[model samples]
Target: MIETVIVVLHLLVAIGLVGLVLMQQGKGAETGASFGSGASGTVFGSQGSGTFLSRLTAILATIFFLTSLGLAYYASHKASAVQEAGLPDPMLQIEQAAPEAPVSEDVPVIEEDFTPASAGEDVPAAPE
Candidate 1:
């Protein structure tokens, strides 16, 4: 149950990170700044959306990394527990059996038995 929660959280953070990173503007976007774009001086100051979005992206990325490590640790621990319990692992043990050959052509094939009607009985003639 806990593992499931962690996995879900990890996926969500990963998706959010992708979206945040894509939403952010590239550094070259500031080329418009030299042309005196009004957006350079926003109420949030010069840094504006760049710093806020980058911070959020970083936080989500960190969470994604942590969750990935946690999931790996959990999987390893679970596997070790199964081993410690002395339960047989089917994947670790497999035996191959010998294959048998098909029927050889040298063997005789038998046909079904059938008997024809006797000719001694009065036979009816076909109408012309």
Candidate 2:
């Protein structure tokens, strides 16, 4: 239950991070030729957008890292628990259960003989 919540939270954070990063303008966007109307008078103030968005992004990134680590730890712990129960790995059991292919040696082969029959005699024409 807790793992599910963590996974959902991680996904939301990842989506929000992508949106925030996309909304922020690149450094090259400040040039007059890019926006055509200039970048002055924005919602986040003159220079505040970069500082605020960058900080928020950093926080989200940290959370993402933590959740990732937690997921890895949980997965490894579960795998070890499974091993301790003495249950054979499904993949190994599948490989062992598969039967080997049987060899076949009874097939008949045909060969063509190309020698001409009665080489010195004239052949008779068949009636139509």
Candidate 3:
């Protein structure tokens, strides 16, 4: 349950980080805003959305990293727990379950003639 929650939070933080990055203006965008492009009219005030979005993005990134670590921990622990449980390995189970072929003494044997070809035999010519 806790792992599931962490996974969900990680996904939400990742999405939010992407959105925040996309929403923030690049350095070149400031030139247009300076010439009355109306960036000052944004909800974050006259300084524009830079500081607010940047801070939010940083926070989300931190959360994303933490959740990643948490997920890794959970995975490692789960693997260890499975090992401790003494469960049969999947490959071993498959090998054990396979049926062995029967050894029959009455099997038919194929015989082949090994005589060398005669010079008069009709051999196909090799393509040039």
Candidate 4:
């Protein structure tokens, strides 16, 4: 339920943001082209207190933040949800064959004489 609501809100914001942006003129647009104001100083402020698109953008941005928070909150608490409701260990239902023992190839072995008995034998009993 929570996820659905968040997704809906997210989608709505995405669409609305696009539409709102398209409806507003670009920054370089001529002020006098449409309203003939020619960038004149306004009573509201230098550039006007705020244009409709700017205000709408602010509102949509706030909604986007709220929906994002809602989604995060919902995700954090979703551990209690089960993949399948009222089902017990559905994965155990499938039967799997037993694993086979691995076989190894035979290899020849080489041995080396490391003892020191032959070393002193060559001395021929210095004090026998």
Candidate 4 worst ten-residue window by lDDT: 89-98
Q: How high is each candidate's TM-score?
A: 0.65, 0.72, 0.67, 0.48
- Number of backbone clashes in candidate 3: 0
lDDT of each: 0.85, 0.83, 0.87, 0.71
Error of 3 at 81 (Å): 0.6
**Tens-digit lDDT track for model 4 on 31-109?**
5546776444655454643486789898998999889888887775553354335454345545334445666567557
Candidate 2 — which pairs collide? none
Q: Give one digit per residue, the lDDT tens place, for model 2 in 22-47.
A: 97779876675355654466677656
Report the lDDT tens digits of candidate 1 across residue range 109-128.
89877766578666776799
Query: What ranges in model 4 sit over 4 Å off?
Result: 31-50, 80-128
lDDT of 3: 0.87
Clashing pairs in 1: none
Going through the candidates in order, what is the number of backbone clashes in each? 0, 0, 0, 0
Off by over 4 Å in 1: 40-45, 93-128
Clashing pairs in 4: none
RMSD of each: 10.5, 6.2, 6.6, 13.8
lDDT head-to-head 1 vs 3, winner: 3
Residue 125's C-alpha lDDT in candidate 2? 68
